[model samples]
Target: MDLDVFVTAHRAEWDRLEQLLGRGRRLTGAEADELVALYQRASTHLSLIQSSTPDAVLTGRLTQLVARARATVTGTRRAGWRDAARFFTSAFPAAVYLSRRWWIPTAVLSTLLGVLIGWWVAMNPEVQASIAAPEELRAMTEPGGGYEAYYSSHPAASFAAQVWTNNAQAAAVCLVAGAFLGLPVLWILFLNMANLGVGLGLMASAGRLDVFLGLILPHGLLELTAVFVAAGTGLRLGWTVIDPGPRTRRAALAEQGRAALGMAVGLAAVLFVSGLIEGFVTPSGLPTWARIAIGVAAEAVFLAYVYVLGGRAARAGEVGDVEAADRTASLPTAA
Candidate 1:
C-alpha cells in the first residue's frame, strides 16, 4: 500500500528489464532467463500499483512497459508461404463472393451501357463522323489499321507489363477513392464503357465489327470483369459510409474497407491473366474462336472459385477481415 516503498523495491528490477530489452538480439542464455523473470516481476508490480494506487502517470508508464515486454517475450510472427496460401484460398475469394451483390450488377449495367452506346454509334453515320474524320476513321478501323496494330505496338512482355500496371493503378484508384462516396469509381467506369462504345461503333461503322470482337473478346472478358469487381467494391464501400445498418458508420466503413483491400490484391492477379491474353492471345495467329475460348475458360474458372471456395468461406463467417484474435476490442453498444 506504500507507493514509495514499492517503487524503491522494484525500481532495480525494472531498470534491469529495460537494459535486457535494449540488448537487441544478442542476449546470452542467462540474460534471456533473467529478462523473463524481470518481466513477470514488473507485471506483478504494475498489477499491485493499479489495484492500490490512483497514480495515472505511473499506471500509464507501466502499461506501456508491460505491453512492450510482452511483445518482446512472445516475439512477432512473420508472414510465411502458408499465410499467403491461406489468403488466396480463403480470404480473397470470400471477399469476392461477399461483394458479388455489388460487382454483378456493375458488370450487367456496364455491359448494357456499352452495348447501347456501341449500337448508337454504329447505326448513325453522323455519330461516326462526329467521332473522327473519314480518313482518320478509315486509318483506325480498316484492315491492318491502328485498332489492330495497337496491341502489337510494343513487345509482348512490355505490353503485358504496361497493361498490368495500368489496370492495377485503376483498381487501386477505385479502392482508395471509395472513401469519397465512390464518385471517382463511377466516373472511371463510365469513361471505360464510353471508350469501349466508341471503339465498337468505329469498328462496326467500317464493317470490321467482327474483327473488333475477335481481338477484344479474347482479353476484354476477364479484363472488364476485374474492373467491374473493383468498381463494385468501391461503390459498396461508399454505400457503407452512407448506410452503415446496425453498426456505427466507422465500424461499417472499416469492415468494407478491409474487404475492398482484399479485392484490390486479388484483382491484381486477375488483371495479370487478362494482361497476358491482351498481349499474346489478342495478337496471335490462332483462330478467333480459340482465343475467345481461352478468355471464356479463364473467366469461368474465376467465377467458380468465387462461388465455390469463396462462398463456402463466407458461409463459415469469413468476411475477409483480420482474424478475431488480431482485431481490437470494440466497445459494447445497444442494438
Candidate 2:
C-alpha cells in the first residue's frame, strides 16, 4: 500500500488508542501502562521524540509524510542528471576499483587499437588521405603526410571543435553499439582502436607522433576509459547469457544489465566531458607539462569521486538516526 494511505488509515485509530493510553498527556491506569509500553518500544539511541519537544517531533514527521505524498503525486518525474552522477560516483568505483587490475584489459585494448589503426591507415593510404584531408592536399600524405599542414593551416578553434565533435560521436557509438553480448562489444572496441590506430599510425608513419600524442593523450585517457567501460558492460551482458550461474538468464540479465547501463552512463559522461577538454584545451597542442598535469588531475578527480561517494547513504538496517525512527513511531498513524 502507499505510504500516505497506510499512514492515514492507521493514524486515527492509533491516536484514539493513544488517547486512551494518555501518551504526551496525563494518564491513569490503562493509559499509563500503554504509554510505558510505547516508551519502552521506542527507546532507541536516537529517540528524538522522547528527547525533543512534541511540536518539533510532530513537524518532522509531518514533513516526511508530505514528502512521500509529493513523490507519489509526481510520478512522471524521476531523478535528473545530478541523481545520475551521484549514482555513478558511488556505484562505478565500488564495482570496478577494489580491483584496479580491471583497467589492464582496457589499457591493452587501447594500445591494440592504436597499433591496428596505424596499420589500417598505412594499408589504405587513399582512404586515410581522403578521411584525413581532401584532394587538394593529397600530396600532404607523401612526406610525413598533410595532417600537420592541415592542423597548421586550420584555426585552433576550428581544430578543437572538429576533434571534440568527432570524439563525441565516436564515444556515442562506442556506448550504444557495445550493448550486445561480448563479441559485438569486442568488435566495436577493436573497430574504434583500429580506427584510432590507423589515424594516428598515419600520423606516426608520417612522423607526427609527437603532435598526435600531445593533442590526444590528455583527453584520450578519460575518453578511452569511457569507451573501454562500454565494452566491459557489453561483456558483462554477454556473460549473463552465457553463464547465468545459478540464476536464470532472465534474472541474471536484469541484474547485470542494470549495472552495465550504469557503467555505460558513467562512461558517456566521461566521454562528453573529456571531449570538451580535448576539443578546446589539448587540441591546441598545449604545453607538454600542462597536458600531463591536466590528464593526471582529471583521472585522479574521477577516481576519487567515483569510489568515495556512492551508496554511503543510510542502508537498510542503519538508515534513520535513532531520533527519526523514534519520532516516526510516536506520530499518530492516521494523520
Candidate 3:
C-alpha cells in the first residue's frame, strides 16, 4: 500500500471524525452515526498501514484519532460528588440492610461466645493462668493499668486515623477473602471475640468489669457492628459460590462481589466514625453514661439510616451495585 495514497483516501473521513469528536455532545443523529462509521473505517486503515507499510508517524496519528473517536462514540460516565452521595445514601446502606440476616446472627453468636469464654476464664483459675501469668493479668486489669491506658496512649487525631486504617483493612480483607468460602472471615471473628473475652475475663477477675465496659462500649458497639456487616457480606459472597440460585454461578458471584466491594468503601466511613469515638470520646473525661449515650446514639442513627434510606432504595430496586448503565452487559443464559 502506497503511504501517501492510503492517507489521501482516508484523510477526509478521519477529518470528519475529528470534527464530530470536537463537537462533544453537540452532534446530531446523523453526525453521530457518521462518526462511528468513520471511526471503524479509520481503524481498518490503521490496521492495514501497521501490517503492511508500517509507517510510524501515520500509525501514531491514526492511533490518537481512533482513541478520541472511540471515547466520543462510547461516551464516558465520570463519577463526581453526586455519585459518592448516592453510594452512601443508597448503595451502602441497602447492602448492609440486605445482609442483616447474616450479620445479626453472627453478632449474637459471637457475643455469646465471648461472654461464655469470659465466664470460664473468670471462674477457672487454670484458664486465667493459661492465658497469662498472674502478674501480667493484674497489670492488665488493675486500675489505671494497661487496659485503660491503651486508649490514652496516643494523640486522639493520630489514634483515630490509625484505628480507621486498621479497621478498614480488616473489613476489606473480610469482604475479599470471603471468596475463599468464608472460613477466613469466621476465623477473624473468632480471634476478635477471643481477645474481647480475654479482656473481659481479666477485668472481671479484678472486679473491674464495669471499667472495661466503660472503655469499650463507647466504640465497640459501632466498631463490632461494622466488622459483623463485613463478615456477613463476605459469608454471603462465599455462599453465593455454593448456591447461585436463579443466576449462573459466575453472574451471582459477580453481582455479590461488586456489592461487597462497594460495601467496603461504605464500611470504611463507618469505621472512621467509630475510630473517632474510640480515640476521643472513649478516652475523654466525660461521665461513662454520656460516653455510652454518644456511642448508642451513633449506632441508632446508623441503623435508622439503613432501615429508612436503605429500605427505600432497596424497594426502588437498588441492590448496592453500580448503576445499571455502568455495569458490563452479561451474556444471556438459558433458564
Candidate 4:
C-alpha cells in the first residue's frame, strides 16, 4: 500500500470533486452525476486510507475534500413551514413539559416572593420611604398617574412591540446565562420579582391594590409564566453542568442547552400574546372581569398546550432538541 501511488491514482478524481463543488450550484445533469460518483469513490478512498495508513497530512486533506464533496452532493436544507409547525407542536411543548419540575417551582417561589415583598413594603412606611419619596410614590400609584398612564403612554401597537422585544430579550438572557451555573437566571428572576413587589407595594400603599391587580392580572398571568419557564429551563440547564446524572456533563449541557434555546423561541411567541393583552386589553374600556378573563383564557390555553401536547411529546421521547439527523456525533466517553 504505497501512499504515493495511491495519491497519484486518486488525485484526478479528487480534483474533479473540488471543481464540481466550487461551481456553486451551476452543475449540469451529467456533472451532477459525476459529482455523486466522485463523492462515493472519495468516501471509499478515505475509509481505505484511514484503515491502512497513518499519513496525517494526506488523511486530513482527503477528509476535508470528502466533507466538502459530500456537502455539495447533499446540499443544505432550508427550513420551511413544516419545520416551524413541528417545533411548536412537538419540540417547544416537550421542552416545557420536561422542564416543568424546574419552572413550576420557579413560578411558585417568585410569586410568593413578590407577594411577600409587596406586603412588607405596604405595611412598613420605612420601606416605602426607601423605595421613593412620598410625592414620587403618590405620583406613580395615584389614579390618572404614572402607573395607569404607562400602558397607554405609547400607542398600542408600539407598546406591544416594545413589550415583546423586551421580554424576548430577557428570555434570551436567561437561556444563554443558564450555562453560568444559572446564577444570572436567578438574579434576573429576583430583579423582576422585586420590581413587581415594589409596584404592588406602591399600589397597595396608595389604596389602589385593586387597580393594580386589575391592570396587571390580565397580562401578567401569561407574561410571568413565560418568564418563569425561561428561568426554570435556564436553572435546569445550569444544574446539568453540576450533575449530569448518567450522561457526561458536556452531553447533558448540550442537550439541555438546545432545549433551552427552543424554549426561548417558543416563549417569545407566548410573550407576544401577553404583550398584546397588556397593550390592548389592559388599557381598554372593557370591564375588569372581561380583561382578566381574556388573560386567564390565554394562560389556560398555554397550560393545556404544555400539559397535553408537550406531555405526549415528551412521553414519546421528544426532548425539544434538534432532529437526530442534524445532531453532531460525539466521541465515545466513559459514563
Candidate 5:
C-alpha cells in the first residue's frame, strides 16, 4: 500500500500510454497492443488508488490519463443521419409509448379540468366578472371578435414559426423541470388549461361557444396533446425520483433523463405540425367542420405513430435510451 512505490513502479506504463495517445503518427501493431496492455494496467492502478489510500493529485492525474487512453482505444464515432432516422422511427415513439401510463391520464385529467373550469366560468357571472370586464368580454365574443381575429392577425408563416417556438419552449421546460419533482410541470399544465377555460367560458357565455370550439379544435387537439405528453413524461421523471424501483437512484434518473431529452426533441416536431394548423387552418374561410376534421386527422395520425411504431419498438425492448455503446462506462465498484 506504499503510494510512492506504486507510482514509481507503474510510472513507465502510464507514460507509455500517454505517449501513444499524444502521438500524431499511427502506431504499429505491436505498439498498439502494448498501448492496450498499458492502458489496462493504468486503469487497474487508478481503481486501486481510488479504493485505498486515495491521494487527490494522483487520482486526478490518473483519472485524466485513463479517460484519454480509453477514448483513444475506443475511437470516437460522430452521429450521422442514420442516428436521426433511428431516433425518430424507434427511439422517440418508444419513449412516448413507454410513458403512456403517465401522459394518457394527464391528458384526460387536464381536459376534464379545462371543461370544468369552462363550465364554472360560464355558469357563474361572478367568475366571468373576475376574469374580465363586461366590455372586454363583449369585445372578445362579438362577431369577428378577438378570439377569431387573433389567429389571422399575423402572416401565416411568421405566426406558425412564433407558435412553434413558444410551444417547443414550453415542452422543453416541462421535460427539464421534472428534476424538481414535477411540481412546475403540473403548475404549467394548470395555467395552460385555465387560460383555455377562461376563453371557453367567455365565448360560451356570449352564445358563441360553437365559434370557440371551431377555432380551438382546429389546432388545439394536436397542440395540447403534445403539451400533455411533455408534462406526463416530466411527471414520470419526478416519480422516478420518488421510486427508482430496483435501479439505483442515479442510474434511474440518468436513464429517464436521457429519454426525456429525446422526447423533448420529438415533441418539438409534433408541436410544429400543430403550429402550422393553428396558423393556417384555424383562421381560414373553410367551414368549421372541415377545419375540425383536419385537426382530428392530424391528432389521429400522431396517436397512431405513438401506438404503432412506439408500441412495436417498446415490445422489442427499446426504452428510448441511447445505444449501450454510446453510454459512459461505469467504473468498477467493490462488492
Candidate 6:
C-alpha cells in the first residue's frame, strides 16, 4: 500500500481501538484488566509507528483520541486506588477476623511449633560452628575462637556490612521465594522461626541472654514479622496458582498477588528499619529496657501506619461495592 494511504488506514484502525478502550472504562474486574491490556498493546504499536517515521503527521483526530485514552488510564488508576480503599474499609472486619481467626493462628502456631522441634537439628554442634562462628575471627581468636578473632580483626564496619548484606539477602529471599507464592512463604517462615529459636537457644546456653536481647529485641521482632508477612503473601499467591478455588489460577493469582504485594510492601519497609536498628543501635549496647522500648515504639508506628492510616485511604468508596464483591468472589482467599 502507498505510504500515505497506509498511514491513514492504520490511524483509522487505531482510532477505533481507542474508542473501544474508552468504552471499556465502564467495565469492572476481569473485563477492566482485559481492556487495560488491550490499550497497552495499542500504545506499543503507536510507539513503533512514531519511532519509524520522524516526520509522521499527527492527525488531529488521532492526537485528540490519544489524549483521551491517557486521561482514561489515569482515571482508571485513580479508580483502582478508590477500590483499594473500599477493600480496606470493608475488609477491616476480615483483617480483624484473620487476627483472631483460629485457622490463621493455627497455621502460624503450628509453623512455630515445628521450628521448636527443629531447634535441636539446627543447633547440631557442627551446624553451630559454621553459622555462629564469625569467619573474620581467624586472626583474633587464635585460630579457634572465631567470634573473638572475627570482631578483633575488623572494626564494627565489618559487622555493619555483614548485617546489611544478610538483611538484604533475606528481603530478596522473601520476594523471590514468593514465586512458589505461599508454599515458599511457609518455608521462609519456618526458616525464620528455626533461626530465631536456635539463636535464642545459643544465647541462653552461653548466658549472654542480655547481650542477645540488646542485640535482637530491638529489631528482631519487626524484621521477623515483616519476613513472615512477605512469606505469607507469597504462599497465598502460590496457593491461588495451585488451587485457584473457583476462579482460574490466573484470576485468583492476580487478586491474591495484589493483596499480598500490599502487605509485602509494608513489610519491606520494616526490614530496612530493622536493619538500621540492628546495624547502628543494637551493637552499641543500648540498655535492655531501652531496646525493648524502642522495639515497642516501632511496633506501634507500624501498627498505626498499616491498620489505622493505611487501611483508610482517601479514595475509599470510589469503586462500587457490587464490583468489589464480584472481584472478591472470584479472588483467592487469604488471611
> Model 1: which residue pairs collide?
none
Q: In candidate 4, what are the lDDT values of residues 163-196, reduced to their tens digit?
A: 9999999999998899999999999999999999
Q: Whole-model lDDT, candidate 6? A: 0.53
Each candidate structure's TM-score, on Cα atoms with residue i matched to residue i, is 0.80, 0.55, 0.80, 0.80, 0.85, 0.55
Give residue 144's lDDT in candidate 2 (0 to 100).
Answer: 34
Give a tens-digit lDDT track for model 5, residues 82-109. 9999999999999999999999999999
Q: Can you write out model 1's per-residue Cα lDDT over 114-196, one digit (the tens) per residue? A: 99999999999999889889999999998889999999999998999999999999998988788899899999999999999
What does the lDDT read for residue 272 in candidate 4? 95
Checking candidate 3 for backbone clashes, the offending pairs are none
What is the number of backbone collisions in each predicted candidate, taken in the order shown?
A: 0, 14, 0, 0, 0, 10
Best by lDDT: 5
Cα distance off (Å), candidate 1, residue 256:
1.7
Question: Compared with the true structure, what per-residue lDDT tens digits does model 3 show for residues 1-335?
Answer: 78888778878888888778777467778877888889878877876666567788888988899777766767876889999999998999999889988999999999999999889888999999998898998888888899999999999999999999999999999999899999999999999999999889889989999999999999999999999999999999999999888766766898999999999999999999999999999999999999999999999998999999999998899999998756543434556
Assess the local accuracy of residue 192 in candidate 3 as a C-alpha lDDT between 0 and 100.
92
lDDT (Cα, tens digit) per residue for candidate 2, span 41-82: 332211333333334554465444433333332333555786
Tens digits of per-residue lDDT for model 6, 225-318 = 5555555445545656667776555555555555544444444446667767666666555677887788778866766655554445323532
**Candidate 2 vs candidate 5, lDDT winner:** 5
Mark the regions of model 1 whose C-alpha exceeds 4 Å error after superposition.
1-75
| Stronger candidate by lDDT (1 vs 4) | 4
lDDT of 3: 0.89
Window of ten residues with lowest summed lDDT in model 5: 326-335
Tell me how candidate 5 scores on lDDT.
Answer: 0.91
- Give per-residue lDDT, candidate 3, residue 94: 91
